[model samples]
Target: MLALPKPVKRAIAGPPVRRDGQQLDLDIQLLLRLLTPRRPQPVPPPEQMRAGQSFVDRVVAGPEEPGVRREDRTVPGAVADLRARLYVPPPGPDVVDGALLVYVHGGGFVAGDLDTHDELCATLAAESGARVLSVDYRLAPEHPFPAAVDDCLAAFAHVTAHPVEFGAAPGRIAVGGDSAGASLALTVARETSRDGADPAGRPVFCLAFFPVTALDGHTRSRELFGDGFLLTGEAIEAMAGWYVPEAMRDDPRLRIAEGDLSGMPPAYVATAGFDPLRDEGEHLVTRMREAGVPATLRRHPDLVHGFATSLGIGVRPRQAVAEAAGALRTAFALLGAT
Candidate 1:
């Protein structure tokens, strides 16, 4: 992995500390030290967007794990062709019956692409033994709201309809992502469940890692950890503004916490203790369960937002991803058995 910038390295040279009643993991503290001093500029002009993407790429990129074959392809999108990266693990008896996980990468709906999340997708594919498809959805300020959502729906429909084309089982499909991508997954799930028009399919399960469930940033977690933990309140606000139209900020599609999640598929939500989005992500699962939907919550009490993207830095993230992958495998196995 590449070394963090000089100023960031200097910031990490200190004893570990605690925040919000949780002891920050040493790795997370180091990550925060790497990110705290330098704030990323808002993504608008083409140049700024590229710079933001480059920064995240450096922060999260890591060596690809072995045993996974990666392929880059394009899927039909609502407007134009959307780029997608597929990760197929080595053949094995443990591989599910051609299960496919359509993963969306997080960049606050503004930055990040196929390359930034390349290793994470490979890790998921290798760990779960399921083909993982990482979508390069349209970003904000250019594509804006509904563009990314539309592309995700279209991509899911395409993959599910032509499972054989993607080497996936007919009915075994799941959706997952981190941060904004998680929000997109949930939104896609809600839309699919509501439409019921896709006689061909719906997601069987969902794995969200610290999702941005609501646009309103008044939650306790936001108030507590919004400043120091990489994802700050100002940053989230800026991204949300760019992604959502002023009048549609409260739309259920964007603010998933307010949406009716009654018929949603089984879900597993992972939250970081020091993440500003923690409360909302946990709350979404609680709402799902209350609506008679099967949902599970896993809170990493010592980590911060984007922990999963830092798998190369520590064991916690890798372990978390492995556990989520196990849950995904078990879900598919149960569906196959049924």
Candidate 2:
């Protein structure tokens, strides 16, 4: 694996940050503090945001895990053809047979693509020892609201129907993603496994990392950590404006927290300590459990939103993501996906 510059790594290895019974990771506190302005500022336009994110990803995300193979392919989506990448981990005894994870990349509905989350996805497969399909759904502005959701569902459907073609064993599909993608992944999990849904069509598990479930909830975490945490309230509103029209912001599909959560497969919802979306993600786990779905919410108190994307950068991030990937692997095995 590639390492960050010596100076950068050394800076993050400094003294710890503690507050509210939680310790903020040095990496997030330092990097985001350096980047964040004293006063909150509006994010750039969609195109600039995309470019900036891509550039930052390259600078921060070092490299893909060695020995994990990658293959690019086209997936049939609801709106248009979608791009996707399949990841197969290094050969190992723990590798599950006929199991796969359908992953979605997060960009708050606008920025991410197959390349931005390349190392992150590779880590998921490397740590879990399971095949992963990372989908590149349509972005906002060009394709809004249900466009991303529809594309994801279509990719999952295609992989489920033709597992062998995608280098997976049959009937062992799982769903996962981070941030915005986590919302889509959880949505797919809910829709495919809801009440009265066919057993054969349901996913075995859902793996979400700091998911964005509801924008209107105005939770305590949002108020406390919305600014200077890499992802801000202003940024959220801007992205939402581009992705969802005001008239349809109330759609249950967009605000998944208010939607039905019953009859879904077991889930592992991971959250960050200082993320504006933290409350909503944890809330989803709580509601899922209340609805009788076996769910677990793991909070990484030392991290912020997008920690998963920095898997190759900071120690805590890699560890955090690996823990979730391990859960994904266990879920696949325990649920008979292996």
Candidate 3:
């Protein structure tokens, strides 16, 4: 077979064209081009969940870093045992007492598991030089409100009590997550701090990526980015319905926007400009700062929701994760100094 010219092949495989009136980052545009084109289908919830998992499995890269060691374990949960993955990086020359980051995966509280976030967790461990524990909390609709929350709390407590076993310093633990996971992480931090939990059991800091701080969908970002962006308003509502009962939606525990932020751990909140949850995440950071909780916010104006999970696709997402990991290292350094 005759080989095509390089220029012609490059032209044929060019980046995807940008949508009209959309201002997405170039990397994201390229990622969209690489994804398989498909017509929207209305599958049953169970089937849709399975399809989502399959899609994640296909797109997300597998563990490729030899520096990071990964191990799976069944951790004790409030109601039952929860599946968890621990990623530990090799000790560095400067390593004194390393930190542990308990990460909760984001699937809108409906999908996602340890497998879906395996690569991301591994990257975090390697980048931050901290032991990363990714929790597989129960999903909603079947598990419902307080189920996932309870499971995450239990996992955090277990890890805090046994940090030495995970090769982490006893009092140098942090909590973080993306989307629904971020909300859960913040909740755990809030509850732990509020209860005057032991210093060793409390998170030194918290990190959130495009977290859904409130269930309300009336923010300006929601109006602007709710439809065309990856995370639609309809999808958010559906996940909220599946996760929390109507009566409990406004509970401070579930709605971080309405919760007390005083005494909560210092936080680093990152939000994408084109994400529906951008405003709420920003608002949460603002409130936390106003409440005397040290907090920082980083906004990526050209990116969309779930950009953190696209680490394998482009530079911007990787840059964002690297920046977040750097922030984590700073947080741990500050903890050590204190």
For every model in order, what is the number of clashing pairs?
0, 2, 0
Cα displacement (angstroms), candidate 3, residue 200, comes to 2.9
Evaluated at residue 180, the lDDT of candidate 2 is 91
- Candidate with maximal TM-score: 2
Q: Give the per-residue lDDT of model 2 (tens digit) for 48-124.
A: 99998898787677566989999998889996788889998889897777789989999989999999999999989
TM-score of 1: 0.92
Local accuracy by lDDT, each model: 0.83, 0.84, 0.80
Q: What is the lDDT of residue 40 in candidate 3?
A: 55
Model 1 vs truth, CA RMSD: 3.1
By TM-score, the better pick of 1 and 2 is 2
Model 1 has how many clashing residue pairs? 0
Pairs clashing within candidate 3: none
Report how far residue 122 has shifted in candidate 3, in Å. Answer: 0.7
Candidate 3, residue 164: CA error in Å? 1.1
lDDT by residue for model 1 over 211-291, one digit each (tens)? 998876689999999887778898788888888899887667887877577888999999999899999999998899988
Cα lDDT of candidate 3 equals 0.80
